[model samples]
Target: MREFVVQQNQSHSVLITGSTSGIGLAIAHCFARAGHHVMLHGLADNETADALRAAFAGYPGNQGFSSADIASEAGCAQLVADTREAIGNPSILINNAGIQHTAAAHEFPSDKWHQILSINLSASFFLCRELLPAMRAARWGRIINVASVHGLVASENKSAYCAAKHGLVGLTKVLALENADHNITANAICPGWVETPLIQPQIEHIAREQQIDLETARAELVGAKQPMARATSPDAIGELALYLCGDFAGTITGAALPVDGGWSAQ
Candidate 1:
């Protein structure tokens, strides 16, 4: 890890999508702190993401913004264009923008289903489609998709989320194979539960739906899992992405690396 940290070059441009908060923000800070140029993007307010960008202006490398919602084609195009303009074509792309909607499979609203797929699945694909040309021309890149333990196994609720993450794994594999000739690698990180804003709403809804104390509900959800029995931290993800983009992981691609604390190991 120290060698990896020391190897960080300030010149590398890393584009981290959906980086306004949660795992995305953590990754952004990780790369920045590690001395890489970072371009952060998300379905964020123009002013807010820009404010965050401004805060990083004093950092050693370039910091930038992409305010467009990544779920739409136009938004994705804008993101690619803005990212290219800000830094160069990203040598590292952490496809971390995602959303989750929980409901019984039968009661899942149609709009929610579409929304989840658009943001979590389709957007990731489009971002890759738009950026791959540059990466291929460079002959090296890392595409790290933030997937979930749900991609490996099922939960009672979160049908649409599972579908999208499961698809992400498949997508990662295909992208890896397709870009192998260019030395561009694609991989998925299947995290169990993380204490991100994305999960808070589900926690609140679960607490209300089950009529349990929030703390108790949280424990119940976590206790059901194995090993460390707690959610992974966002910084942990940041560190992982940092490593995946490093030269040490040059040979690792198309692998669904589970950063889940042994949850999917069961």
Candidate 2:
């Protein structure tokens, strides 16, 4: 156990996975706007990475992009190496990359189950292992895991997703406890019904199957679990991530904070 460093309002170097689009993109923007140098990561080609990097040119701090595959332990290490080369060692790490598949537990494909766990759960572990040393040395760090509301509650036909997210929540708690005295806070943000491109196909399928308009389909999809009858915006989740990294939230660790429109309340 070591003493905690009270860091505030200082520009930090950040690494965000799955940041080419969706929720990850939103979170990247928030941190960049706040003057933190950001390393945006995803599985994209050079051209796409350049375009993504250009999009952040207007931000106050530096932005870098990487398409490093985080599906393996080596890939995760490579991503951390690239980030260190691009923007100093990242003081902030956001594990936002995940994939989903729908099938009953009995019908779930073994390959899909392994893939989901590798990317969603194991990649985070690898990255944390790679980054924790520097953070502990510096005596200040923030780790925000973008887990799902399913991490807090179960959902049928999402066995792999549920398992990965739930494991991620458990991991967050352990990281928090291990680093409590080192000033590195670890927390998970559990979002439900976010209107990302990832879920657009499901929404369309619901609309077609229910014989309803897209707007109605959207409502029904969200209303099924979330009590607010609307999806949470990616920006809202981004704001929460930003706040968690701030001085006021220094002591808030090991929390599975839900931004699920009260879905977890039900």
Scored by TM-score, the top model is 2
For model 2, state the Cα shift of residue 53 in Å: 1.0
TM-score of each: 0.88, 0.96
TM-score of predicted model 1? 0.88
Runs with alpha carbons beyond 4 Å of true place in candidate 2: 1-6
Off by over 4 Å in 1: 1-10, 197-218
lDDT of 1 at 183: 76
lDDT of 2 by residue, 44-106 (tens): 988998898889999888888888899999999999999999998999999999998889999
- How far in Å is the alpha carbon of 127 misplaced in model 2? 0.4
**Residue 31 miss distance in model 2 (angstroms):** 0.6
**Candidate 1 RMSD to the correct structure:** 3.5
